[model samples]
Target: MSSSTQVSGTGVVAPPDSTGISIIVVGGGFGGLSCAIECKRKGHSVVVLERVPGLHIQGDVISFGPNAGRIIQRWGLHDKIWELCRHVDKLVLHNYLGEIVREQPLPLPLWGAWGYDGHRAEMHQVIYEYAVSLGIDVRFGYTVQEYYEDDAGSKAGVRVEAKGEVVSMEADLVVAADGVKSKARKYILGYDDKPRSSGYAVYRAWFNGQEQGVDTDPLTDYLTKGEDAFFGWIGRDVHFLASSAKGGKEISWVITRKNDFEVTDNWSFPGKMEDVLAVVDGWEPRCAATLAKAPSCIDWKLIIHDPLPTWISKSARVVLIGDAAHPFLPTSMQGGSQAIEDGVVLAVALQLAGKDNLPLAVQAWEKIRYLRVRESQLIGEDVRNRWHRCQPGDRGPMLDVPRPEWLFAFDAEVNAYEVFESVARDIRENGYNRPVLPPELAP
Candidate 1:
């Protein structure tokens, strides 16, 4: 990402005891940025190669649970980041006809909890701008065509397409934060790790309220007020979630329904308005009206894959971090959070392992994270199952979104420090262990 503006940054200074390790992070999304930022914080020389030429400030709402929130705070941006987020006081749940089921308050105060629910592009800027302030070497428009590592040479790297020619860049560690269609996956796994259809797809839209004429209708004008609101509608085989943020200036909604399209490299396409309306027929009037206010929408297919055997390659010099390693369902609401956790933990693992024992560090990091990530991924599936199977009149616990302390209460950096030594020792002696096996998260 290229920028001419000066940034004061979070005043996060790199440590003096540099790891003396060279790292290359592929991708410029949230996950990739997090890894590069954390690695730099730990005094490692890092370069981020993003295929995009400039920061594309696209995307609607994004969330950062407390688990990821704590890491942002450490970078001294807790307030600056969360301030731009919508102030969602509660999440109201209802049946298809707007029958109120439950009105759940924000699990914790927005600022106190440190978790943020805000615009995706804005949240990204919060992290990216900080990375720039720290004077990080982020090379935009650099696309990785392939990933490689040499155990013999004790290095890892990626070949990028530059000036219509391939350029090779090597580093001690190469992190694939490349998203779902990650080129690194096949290279790391020695096979095409294809994604399966989740049998569900989300039709989503985001637009400004007053600008879209939403406030003109009494049926939907409530959304134009200067207060953020969240509402969910559950049904037999579908669920709809909508929220208004930025003091009701803008609105966004997502409706999940069964999908039968063939899987391809393309995961999103323009959604048909009729199809979107059909999903909510005979449902809440306000819900339909709000959806009607949407100027445009996209059909986003939720893709899944059976958990991989490993995120690290044979050489251990290359590793997958975010969506490249694990993709979470929307219901899980922890995809981005988990990706951030991976970056933080991996950086900590590298520090503890020292520069020479790089293999041990990456292995220990995977072992430490694998099971917890699997368990977290399943949470989204379970929530979707429960909501999709809901009988219209269900009540009480059945209409709950579980934000268990186990998931949100985690402090990744501290946890990494606590577990690294023993996990590294265990991996060195006995190899990696898999204690939990969540069923394949595919329909």
Candidate 2:
């Protein structure tokens, strides 16, 4: 194993902190960027290494439940989020024939309770721009190759291939915010089990309001002019979801199905326009016509993993966050949200632990975060099963009347700090109790 005491590869000897700790965030996606921003706010020097040059704005509109909405607000981007997003008032469920079978109102309590909804493009800009303003040293085209933790597990760092040069950067803290297939995770924990395909393919695309005309039919429209809505078709073995973005100027949609058929791994790989049109074969005329107007479609193979028992490494020096820690299917629509939660909770844990006891702080963070993320992962799985059914069946908890209060009511910012303090108390009282590490995290 490589040591964290020095920054190798780069001739410049990057000095360690004298006043505060240093952190390196691998991956510049939503999760990684959020972690980098929060770490800087708390008086830490941070660097974010992103393989992509700048942000790659894709996906039409990404939905965020109340839990994630609240985090965006606390991050001071609520106004911008609302400005950039169209507010969704309800979610409508349809059958394969495009008949509106069920319509569930957006949980009202979620509004004042947790507070807002998320629009993907707007949320991305808010986070990205804010990180830039905070003086976060984000270097694009820097790909991380591996992570090296100290033998004593006292500190962790990573090596990156930036601008055709391999540079080893050391920090008091290292975050593996890399996506589902994370190199940092593989090096730190020593496992390279790639994300397994869940036997489903998804077709996604966004349409500008001008070219893809909006529907005025009351019966066919899922959302009114001002209100955005999530409309979907659920069957025994397949499902499709659609919604508007940027206040209805654009529509984003996805189709998911089981692996009886083959699909590609790329999330943005193009699909035959006719194939998508064919999938909604029997959809209501109005819905069918609207879908037919889609300009293009991107197809991707869906992947998932069995719930890991825990997320903490035994040494407790380096742990996974975001997709690295818990990769979920789109059925939950909470991947970005959960990743945001991971970054915040981890930051709060370290904050509470203070700088003196880094080891104990890491342990406490893992203990508090494991159960919540695990429960969420199971909920996502249940959702996937219910959504991808090929034949009609009674709606499960996902479509249950009066949706579960636990999900929409979650407030990550408040709950995050609250959970961190609670876990710290437990560790203080019981001593260093070693919980079982998740199968994914286990060596």
Ten consecutive residues with minimal summed lDDT in candidate 2? 8-17
Error in Å for residue 258 of model 1 = 0.9
Off by over 4 Å in 2: 1-19, 107-121, 214-229, 260-268, 390-403, 425-443
Q: Return the TM-score for each candidate structure.
A: 0.93, 0.84
* 178-234: candidate 1 lDDT, tens digit per residue: 988989999888999889999999998888888988778987876666687788888
Question: For each candidate, what is the lDDT?
Answer: 0.84, 0.67
> Candidate 1's C-alpha lDDT?
0.84
**What is candidate 2's TM-score against the reference?**
0.84
What number of clashing residue pairs does each candidate have, in the order they appear? 1, 12
Best by TM-score: 1
lDDT of 2 by residue, 243-350 (tens): 775556667677776554442344456788787777766666655555655788777767765544445555666667888878877766677878887877676666
